[model samples]
Each structure stands twice: as C-alpha cells, then as structure tokens.
Target chain A: MLNNKEYLNKLYQSDKPLIIYKTDKGYDIYTDFSRRIIINKKNLKYFLNIQTKSKKSKIEELNCYVGFFGYKLLCENIGIKFPKQRSKNFHSGVFYKPQTKISIGKKIIIKSIKPDFRNISINTKKYLQLNKKFNLNLSLKQYSKIFNDFSKNIKQGKTYQIKIAQTYSKKGNINSIDLFWKLMKMNESPESFLIREKDYNIVSCSPETLILKKDKTIRTKPIAGTLRKTKQLNKNKALTFFRRNEKETKEHNMIVDMERNDLSKICKTGSVKIDKLKKVEEYRDLFHYVTTIKGVIKNKMSNHDIISSLMPGGSVIGCPKISTIQLLNRKEKFDRNIYTGSFGIIHSNGDMRFNIMIRTLLNFKNDIELSVASGVILGSTAKKEYNENYIKAKSLLDLFN
Target chain B: MIYLIDHEDSFTYNLAHLLDSIEPTFVSNYYEIDQIKLEKSSTIVLSPGPGEPKDYPLTTKIYNKYKGKKKILGICLGFQQIVFCEGAKIVQQKNILHGYQSHIKVTNDKSIFKKNFNFLGGRYHSLKMAEPFVSQSMIITMRCVKTNVAMAVEDDINKVYGLQFHPDSFLTPHGKYLIKKILSR
Candidate 1:
C-alpha cells in the first residue's frame, strides 16, 4: 500500500521545536488541526499565511495541506478513525468547518513546533512555563493504538468537549493548569485545549474563542459584559436586568454588528442573521453575554474565504476593525504571528470550525510571554480596562511563577 | 474606606497604594461592587476601566447618589463619568496619545494641586477633557493648559472636580498632594 506514514514520520522528527508546514501549497486543503509542519529528510518547508483573499486562479491550484490537513485528508480517504480524539478549537488553530475521516487501520500524523523561537523583551519577573515533555517511550505504533482506543471511547460519549482551546506562553515550561483555573476563579469562563503538533514539544491551554461552528453554517458570539451569578433570580427580573443593563448591551451590540459584517463576505447577505442577542450564559466559572449569529453560505466560498474574513475575531479586534489593528500594531512591539490565529477542523465536504485565540501563551526558550487584553471603548475607565485585561491574564499567570 | 470603584486592578491598585489611604479596595467587577454594601464607607473612589460612562449603570447610580455627597474624586474615566453627570462636556480625542511624560502646565494652585507645582507627571493616556466646567462668579480652583494638552477643571459651582493626571499615582510628584485635597474635603 502506498502509505503516507513514512512521509508523516519524516515531518515529526526530534530536536526542532517547530516545523514549517504547507502540504499542498498549490491547492488549499481543509484541515481542522493546526499542528502543521512540513518535514523532509533534511529541511522544513515554508508556508505562506495570508490575511487577504487569494486570487481564484491561485486558490484553484491548491488542494492539500502540508501537515495535519494532509494527515486528516489521508485519514478520511482511508477511513482510519483516530485511536483517541481530543481536538479543540483553542489549540487546533482555526478550522473553517467540521468534518471527520478515520480509517480502521493505523496512520501517521506529522507536526513540528518551535516553542522557543523568538524572544525580545519579556516580563521575565512574571515568567510563564508553557511546555510539557511527555517522556513516554510510546512509539508511533503505540500512540496510534492509544488513539484508536480513545476514538472508540469517544464513540461511546465517554469523552466529550464542553470547551475547546489552544494556548501558549513565553517560557517552555508549565507546572499546572491551576493558574489557568485561578483566572477562571476570577470570573473567567475558561476554554481549555492541548496539542503538540506531531508528537511533543509545546502544548496550549486556552480560555476563549467567541464563536463555534458546525458544517457550512457558522456562529460568532462576542463576549462583552460579565456578571458572576450567585443565585438565580425570577425570569422577568433576570430578563429586565440583562436587557436594562446599559453597558453590557452596547458592548454586545457592537460585537454583533461587527460579526454580521464579517459573516457577510462568505455567507449570503441576507442569510447572516442574529439568531439570538444578549442571552446571558452561565458557564462553569463565568457568566457572559453570548449572542448567536447564524447564516447559510452564499457564494461557493471555500473554507479559506471564511477563515480569511474572520481571522482575528471581532471581540479581540474591537469595534472599528482597521483602526484597532493599526492602533495596537503601533503600541504593541511583538509580532502576533499565530498567537491570535485560531485552530479547528475542516470537513472533507468543506465545512470547518474554529475559535478566538484568547488567553494564549508564546513560549520563549529561556522565558515565556503570556498576555491578555480587554477591548477599550471611548468612555472606558483606564483602571477598569486594565483590570479586565488583568483578570483575563490570570489564567496563565498563576501557571508559571 | 476607599473603594477604587472600577476594574483594572493592577493600575488601580498601583494608584490606590500611592494614595496611602487607611483602607483601599478595587471594585471593577460589578458583581463585587454590587454585593458589597456601600453604606459604611466614608469615601467612594471610582477607579478607571474599559467602556464609556453611558454604559455603566452602577456607576451612574453611584454618581447620582453620591452627588458629591462624600468627598469625591474622579480619575481618567471616573473623572469623565462624574463630570458628565454633574453636567459638563467631554470631547472625543481627535488623536489618541498614550504614554508617560507630561506636557501640561498647571497654573492654578488652589483646587487639588494646593501646594506643590511646577512639575511633570508620568502619564500614559488616550483621552482628553474638552471645555471642562469651572465657576465664573466664585473661584472654581481650576486651570486649563490645552496649549500643553493637560487640563484640570473644577465645577466649584457644583463641588465637582476632575483630574487629567493620575493624581493618586507617584508618577506625578505632587499627585498625592492633589488627592489629599479631595480626600480631606
């Protein structure tokens, strides 16, 4: 059998923390997993990531991804179900839609990560250890076996995902998720995830993504206001409080409008509709304003188009899109790179799913860079804005030092 | 007790510590602010945080109730909120300027900056106050150095005061002195 295992193993080598990945650069392939790295006998390939839409001619030639996307395609084509499945939007990066393909037999998946790649001036006093070294002597075969068994359990609903994510830090070492939990304790509805590309290097534990998706349809919910509920009040009072609350609604409505415009490019014009607005949702640790926007795809837009339009979700970007990006770009020194990019799965049929890249960490070889920020409105109190970001930052802070 | 009645704990805590008050607390999370009874407090301090004033209902209620009831002081966002409610205009900053190092001229020494003067305060701010309220008949104890960008206006007419600089911060040499004026009022 012309197996892709050998090629995948080639990409999952030891030594380097990250690898360059772009499976079929000529053709864009759908991949829910963001564990991408193109490894050869000697070198890792370069993949160009673009925020702008590619010309139709350019996109038509691209078909498959270099790393996990290709692995996912091969698995689906071969019907090899993963032995264990724990894919989350937080760490999976950004998947345009959701699709599953698993073979009964074993398969190979290649991944590369450069955990401690770039480092400038980090808040070393506040170090973040973000790596976990799995020293298990399990080979590709054994790992595959475990995955197979895990997939069987998932089929039984033994393992289900309530929240999904991928996170990073400056230091390549993390003691526990306790710090992440601490942030959650401060009223942060944390979304957690784990990933190391091929085998091992760095793993991510994230707490956010304003949206979740299912097939060609999608949803974008921006978190604006927060109120940790202690007791349930009467329905009418609760409704009145949520509706009457001035600050929360403005924060939410702006995001909804922003999301609607985002969905407009890939989704049908009128198809994009706010299914629900300003519904107070209570997750494990935090209560938030979760609004659902749903729309059917209009143009025969590819998954790339959808992801392109919604790269950094609106909740992170703020109200005015271009201005916010430019404003932050001017102030913030470090490059965002993949730090804010999302991860998820792309169905073979073209549907995909992904989440916002909040509560993230970027590991530095000798140190770590974990950061969190809150959106600032015109009348925002300087102290309040700082505290909001600080609360969001707590998830990763308590983890390292 | 002094409640930094806004979020952004790091910044507020830093300012609160500088004030060196008997009791200082951070209250940006509305839930925390709501649960705590404000009846026993001697002074109410509204710290800074994200979002414009019109959105914060709690702050509005607090503003309406306080109405300079207790010795009140507002910083950055708090300043704008209290001033606007007390009837004043807040103009949008045409260009955002965020960083430290002051470019303002404090001409008045009566209101908040009573004693110390002729100084530069470290500041990182994005917004500005336009045409602040200052009493015409009586001495309002306020000054505007827009030619220098930093302006402080006192509606002594309404017993309300606003600080363009973080007076409760050590970044400004006379910051503590300015805050003392409000606290001891």
Candidate 2:
C-alpha cells in the first residue's frame, strides 16, 4: 500500500487530468477520468441541464465531476457580453468524469474502476523550486487612474463598490505541485485547490466559498474586509477594528447583502437568513471580515440557476453585480480568465460546492500569472487599495522567490 | 399583482422575492416598460439600482402615468426617482452610506411607518433628496436618527411611497414587515 504523498506523485506523473481539492478535513484527489467535458458558450446551457438531470450513482462520493468555470464563461452565463479583450484564449472551462477517486481524510479511501499501481515509482524529491520574479501588468500610475475613475463612478451612484484587478505575470517553467505545496505552507485557505491538466494547471488558496449545496440547503460565505496582519494585531483586535471602522463595516455589509440577494434568487422566500454575521477569519498575511449566509433552495431550482446567480461572486466583483461587472468589463483591458471564476465539484446527486477563484496562480503553457484585486468604495484611497492588491499577491509571488 | 421594474440592480431579485411573498409579482427591466402590462398590476415597484433617478426616465414616466391609478413604491435609487419626479433636487449626500444601518424616526404617523418608534434600516445610496424639500404634496415620513437625512417619503393622495434605505436587506430586521405594510396599504 502506497502512502498519500506517493499516491499523489504517481497520479501527477500519470499526466492525466487531475484535481486535488482541499476540504475542511482533508483532500479529495480525482484522476483517471473517463470523459472530459469542454464547456463553451453554446454548450453551457446544455451542459448545465445534463448535469442537473444526471441520475444518482450507486456510490455516493465517487460519482462526481471536478472542474473549474472561467471568469469570461461565468460572465457570459449571467448574460453580460463584452468585446473580446487581449487574452491567452484559455478554454472557458473543463470538467472530468473520473474513473478513479481517492479521499484522504481520517481514513485513506480509494475507489477506481481498475486499480493498477505497477511500474510506477515515486521520486524521493517530490518537487523542484524556481526563482522567478513577477511583474505587475499595471503600474501605480495606471492603477491610480483607473481607481480615480472608479471613485468617480461610485460618487455618481453608478456602483457602491467595485474590485479593480491587477495581474502579476512572469514567463517561466513552474512546477505547479511544488508551488502549491509551498504556498499552502504559507497560506492554507479553506477553499484551496490544485488542478493539473494536460494543457494547463491551476493552484489556488481561495478563501471565499461562493456556493455549497447539499440537497435542499445552500450556503455562501462572503468575505469582504481585509486588514493586514501585524505583530500586535490578532483576530479579536482585527474584529474590533472591522467593527469600529465604518468603511470596513459598510463594505462588508454590502457584500453580505449582495450575497444574500444572490441566494434569494433561487432560495425560498423567508428562508434566506444570515447564519453567522461579521466574523473574523485569520490568514497568514491578512484578517478577513466574513459572513455566512444560508438559504433553503426552492423546489425544482436547477444547478444552472444556482451557478448563474452566484458565480463571479459579488464579494469579488462588487455590489450591484450586473452594473459593476459592466463597468469592470469596460475598464479592464485583459480578460480575467479564471481569477474570479469558480472551481469545485458537482456530484451526480446534485450536491455541489464551489469557491471563488481568488489568490490563485494560473500556469498556462508556462506563462504563470497571479491576479489580485481590492475593493474600492467611496472612502477608499488609491494608494491604500493599490498596496492592498500587492499584499494579496505577495504570498503567491513569494513562492517564486 | 405587483409590477417590479428592475433597474439592472443586484438587489432587484431580493426585493422581488420580498414583494412576491406579500403578493404575486411580475418583474421587468425598466427598458421593457412597453412590453409589460402595467394596468394589470395593482402596485408598481421600482427596484433599487445604480445611478441617479434621471438615468431611468421610463420609471418616472411610469410614476407619472400610474400615480393615482395604482400604488407606486420605490426603494433606494427608486426612492430618488419618486423625489426627482416630485420637483426635488437629488444631490450628493454629505455622508455616503452604503450598507450602513441607521435608526430611522418616523416624522409622519399617517404614513406607512409607525410614529415615535425608531427602527434600523439598511442604507445604500450616494445621492439624497436635497434638504428643505420644496414639494407640497410629498411628505418626508422618516429621517435617519443620527444624520437626519430623509429616509422615507410618501404621498397619501397619489398613493406613492419611497424608501431610501433597503428594506429587502437582512440588516433591516423589519424589512418584510415594512414591505407587507406598504403592500397592504
């Protein structure tokens, strides 16, 4: 019997489409897929409908598809169309029907159509480190200009809050598994995940859960306020700061309301309520103000309705998701790719869990890119928000150092 | 039936769900005003949205067309539309309060809000109806206890009501109650 690390290495060397999703307890590794569903603009609705109509498998956990939905795909899903921006033209999203499944929690469990481990040897050294410097796509001057424009929009009541994205890119060969491990050591977020595909790889330490559905119950945790962690600042002090600061409280409130509104679209009336309000989540570099909202899913609501209402989550975009997205699409030069997209699993039983893809590194064709953004409200200053973006990207960028 | 004119706002669905709980509601974008059967609806609800009321001239037209015929209710930007149509200037608020909870004091007991009782409401707007309200028909019903900014207004004769704060928000505990009260009236 192989150990967990050895099993992961074997799967990684297989060069098959794979995903290692981190749950609250442990990791769920999916490999040896039978089919790959490449989602596009035309087939999105069809794909969603099919997934919704899938029959429950005899085995519960093994019957699932693990994949990601890109930012452009989610935007289009919600009926927001924009002119094509300069991008690497990554596939909108891809999902896999896995034949082999491994769950590494208190007990290691493996379920596969054919379990064959012969002729595969694990390397003593699991990963190689790389030293590459990342450069921001937008300079301070450019970001400031965009920030001022967004501020003007906020003042005009065009949007209450908007997130301005900035990308840090570097051309280099990256061992995604190696980088994922290193970043996890530094910042092990709850919604973290790693995907290794033939064409591309995604490593994320995303902290926000856009949607988590089980049967008729659905929940979302919207993270809004961010405070840089210091020697003197702890979770309690950070909570106090978030409570006293009018701007932070207000920003968090807007995100909570927006998320609740999204849930309200598919949730039964009077069932949408805040489970936990204004809680503090501590991370390596920052402390976030988060709120957990739960709702009872309305009868006959399909997976498409839930995904459309929640993807490109409001906490990452802004309040008034539609208008804010339009403003962002107009102002932003590059396609967001999968930055604010969602990554998770959809089970045959209609149970699903997805996380907003923030604090993620996209290593597509050896052009590694890490995108980060900060929420800019009326009281937000350019320099502060600009620096906040760097603080977000610092953990991922430090892996290259 | 309640006719909800969506302003491309995120909270429109929330308000729709709230209104639907009280009465069956039909929602349409403000641009699709011509397509909707406005006469079929007993109440016309203008949803909270981005931008000032001037950006939605069609909503104002609906208010003008159905002022006395049907009950008109507006929230956030919708509230500004009612004030804007009533000959009041919508200016930038001194303190922009988005998603901030404030205690509102009812100034007019004859309106939907109970008099002398303060209640928390969620505010999300950058613009406010300019002070010393010049409209004779529109009466300011509720004002923020701290800022004293106009939080709610109503026209009894025209059966039109507007609320600056979002009653659909969870922050506003009495959100459903307020909606039910307005719809019943």
Candidate 3:
C-alpha cells in the first residue's frame, strides 16, 4: 500500500522506464532500468504489423511493454485511412515489442493493496498551491451538435455506434506530479498507472480493458454503458436502472459483438465466446456495463496479429470501427493523444493486459488534459449525451473537491 | 384510462405506444392508481423492468390490492412479480437469458392470449419460475422451446396474467397482437 506522494517521489527518482498496470484483483509494477526500448514514429519501420511475412524472432524470454497505442497508430496499421486534418500528431505510443533474445534483469512487483504505490515525503508548501478548475474543450452547444450529428449518422446506416469524446483542460501554477498522485488516490481503477517520461507525464484510472493475452488465450474486455454514481442513489436501484437502460444496453451489446469479431480474426474457429456479458461494474464515481470476450489464439499467430485485430478497442471507437474512426477524424478538433489510446504491459512470458485510455490525465508541455466520452446510438439525444460526458468526468473532478 | 406502472425499466417505454393507442388517458406508476382511478381504468399494465421480483416490493402490494377486482397484465419483470405475489418463488437460472429470441410452446392458451399462441417470443430475464417454483394459483401457459423455462403464467380465475417474455419488444413476432388480446379481455 504505497501512498500517492511516495509513489510519485519514487517514480520521479527512478531512472529506468516502468509501467504499473493494476488489474481487477491486483496490480503489476514492471521496470527495466538497465534496458528499455522506446517505440516511436521514427522507429515505426522497426516494427511489423500483424501476420507479416518478414517476421523476425517468434519467441522472447522477458519483454516488458510500458507505453500506449495511439488511435491513429492502430488505424494506420490496420490500413484504414483517416480524413486529412490539421490535428497535431504528438508522440503516441512507446511499446516494447517482444524481443527474440533474453533479458534477465527485468523487475516485476505485485502488490494486492492498490499497487499504484510508492511512499514519499511530501512538500507542504507545494501541497498548499492553488488548484485551477477544469474547463471543457467544447461548450454544451458544440457537444450537443456533435452528438446530434452522430445520432444522425447512426440513423443513416453510416454506423451503428460511435464514441464521442471531449477533453477537459486546466492551466495554472501547479505540480503535475502532485496532481497525478492525487488522481490515483481519489479514483483508483483496475488499470490505474502513472507514467513519467522525460518531457511528459500520464496519470490514469481507466476502467476499460483493451487487450489481454496469456499464452494461447487472448481476450478483450470492452466497456460501453455508463451512469454516474451518487450518494442519493441506492446501489440496487442504480444497478437496476443501468440494467434496464435500453440505450446503454444497445451500446454495450454492439461493442461486445464487435469485440467478438475482432478476436475471431486471430482466434481458432468456434473458440471465441463472451465470457461475461453486460455485467455492471461499479467504480468510484461512475458505473459501467462491461463484457469480457475471450478466444484461444490460433497456432503460430504472433502477438502482432492479436494486437492488430483488437487495437483501438471497439468500445472507445464504435461499431463498424474503421468508418466511424474516419468520420471522427474529420469531426473532432483536438488531438486525442493518449486519451483514447491504450497503456498496458506485454510480459516476456506472453501475458499482457492494456487499458483503454479513458479517465486518464496527461501532461504534455506542462498542459494537463483529461478525456471522457459516451457511446452514441440512434436513440441518443444531444443534451443527454453531452451531459453523460460530465458524469464520466465527475469522479476525477471529485479529486479537487 | 390504462394505468401503467413505470418501473424505470427502459423497456417500459415500449409500452407507451401500445397503451396510448388503447386509452386516451394513460397514467404511469401503480402508486398513482387510486381506488376510484383503479375502478375506472380499463386495465392495469405492469411495464417491464429490471431486477428480480423482490427488488420491486411495490408490485406485490399492487397485486394484492387489485387481484380479482381489475384486469391485470404483467410483462417480463412484471410477470415475475405477479407470480411471486401469488405464493410463487422465483429462482435464478443457471444461464441468465437476455435479448434471446425463441419459440414459447403454448401448453394451454384457453385463458386470455389466443389459442395456438405458440409464436416467437423474446426473453430478457436472469430469473425464472421452473417446475418447483410455479405459483399454486397460477397455471404455466407457455415455456421456451430451447430451455423449457416457464415463459407465461396465468390465473384466469383472478383475471391476472404474466409473461416472462416482453410482448412490447420488436423481437417478439406477435407482440402487438398479444398485447391487444390481453388488454381487450
């Protein structure tokens, strides 16, 4: 049970690149101080997409991945072209692909008591700094218009579902490290992790699981439906409400079907089945409907094939994933960066889990941003959908309160 | 006026069109049904909702209040609630059913729904009344073709009906027709 401050101090002090991925029941802390691989756009050539014939080493002893998959990276890799736009392409992912050779000195830490942990002494003066309020990137009207347009798209048979995202930002004289620590304390999620880079920092408590692989079994948990949790509402009542919400169920079922299709790509025929369907998973400030789809990997199917099949998790984008992504590329204003991206670890032993980058706070060039989105269906209304974003943001916003 | 209890289930919205088409004055919620209003209404329709029978204790109270006095039609969760109030126990199925479409074999449709009621029905329930939990006063009218689970129960003596499947959902082949038949009775 590492306190937030201590964890931040240790994170800043460590020279090695590391990743801390918290699971539903536990957390995994991985670090490789002696050897760390950084995957960037420049080195994109070194990487191979899924099922490439130029495949190099098929086995790696111990590989620890400590980065994310940008929404664009997945689109480009999957051969789905995005609409030309002025959006900036910030450094997206820093994946450490499974290497052929053995790396013996890697570090692995597992703690049961909320592993977004490390203990550190706090500076009282820094703690007393003024906190700034966050502001939405789009106003209610703009969000409404976008939501309405998405609903129209759904009606026109353009797409069955499309995830509409909005970013919240705040500027102030603040400490990003302290904010990261506070977020971890307030809204600790299954995929909770803090990534400290030379120029930027990411603090996340994401609730969505993107990709999980263990040996021949590979799975993806796509989260779709959402409802804000409040003190006035009883747990049973809330669960009932969420369960009967037709709009939410439709959104959730679509993604579950999409995830099943994705897994079927590299999975053995008749091996794919939904392990869990529409289970209401309650988080701190919000509750979500999540379904876990699992499939056995086909023989000789490399990790690349699995990632390609399921990169840019369906829940974050939408059904008919590629086309909706293209539509969003033309629509959304700001770059998603690592917001809709994924952060996880691919172990050397072939076990891995990545979290969809929602409920995540990232600081690049000292500017902090957090993102929240709702799945848009034909029945979705403009105001209601936009309001859903605030509900998603409430947990993180509660950190300030 | 048709009194429709709003259980806050999203599927309850589907009942709006069917109810409105039948009665000009439609009020939502069983609590809103007063003695005079309940007497005046054509029928009391319990809208489909979430949760098990016990989760909605109010529905049981309504069932007790107007058992034989008024026409009653319960759909989905409402159906489970009706049977539970009649001394029946609802048990969680080994495999929870949701958004599943299948045939419901009509064993005895001599009560309200038309004869030869064997038709495509859609179910979305995690709990069902199997052989043991069948209500003492209610008759099992229909069962799913696949799981053989109880799909419809009725107590014609009390003028009460329950359907495990949602007749209001588009998945049901004869949903509108079945709803009209139940209400017309």
Q: Of the candidates shown, which would achieve the greatest TM-score relative to the real structure?
A: 2
What ranges in model 3 sit over 4 Å off?
A1-18, A24-26, A32-62, A84-88, A96-131, A172-177, A232-235, B1-185
Q: Model 3, range B40-110, lDDT digits (tens) per residue?
A: 77677786654567777777887788888887888877887887787777776765445456788787756
TM-score of each: 0.41, 0.95, 0.60
Better of 2 and 3 by DockQ: 2
Please give me the DockQ of candidate 3 compared with the native complex: 0.02
Better of 2 and 3 by TM-score: 2
TM-score of chain B of each: 0.76, 0.96, 0.88
TM-score of 2: 0.95
CA shift of A7, model 2, Å:
3.8
lDDT of 1 by residue, A123-146 (tens): 222333345421212333543443
Question: What ranking of all candidate models by TM-score puts the best one first?
Answer: 2, 3, 1
**Candidate closest to the true structure, highest lDDT:** 2
Between candidates 1 and 3, the one scoring higher on lDDT is 3
Stretches of candidate 2 off by over 4 Å are A1-6, A51-58, A115-131, B33-37, B109-112
Docking class of predicted structure 1 = incorrect
Residue pairs clashing in model 2 are none
What CAPRI class is candidate 3?
incorrect
In the order shown, the candidates' Cα RMSDs to the true structure are 22.2, 2.3, 17.7
Best by DockQ: 2
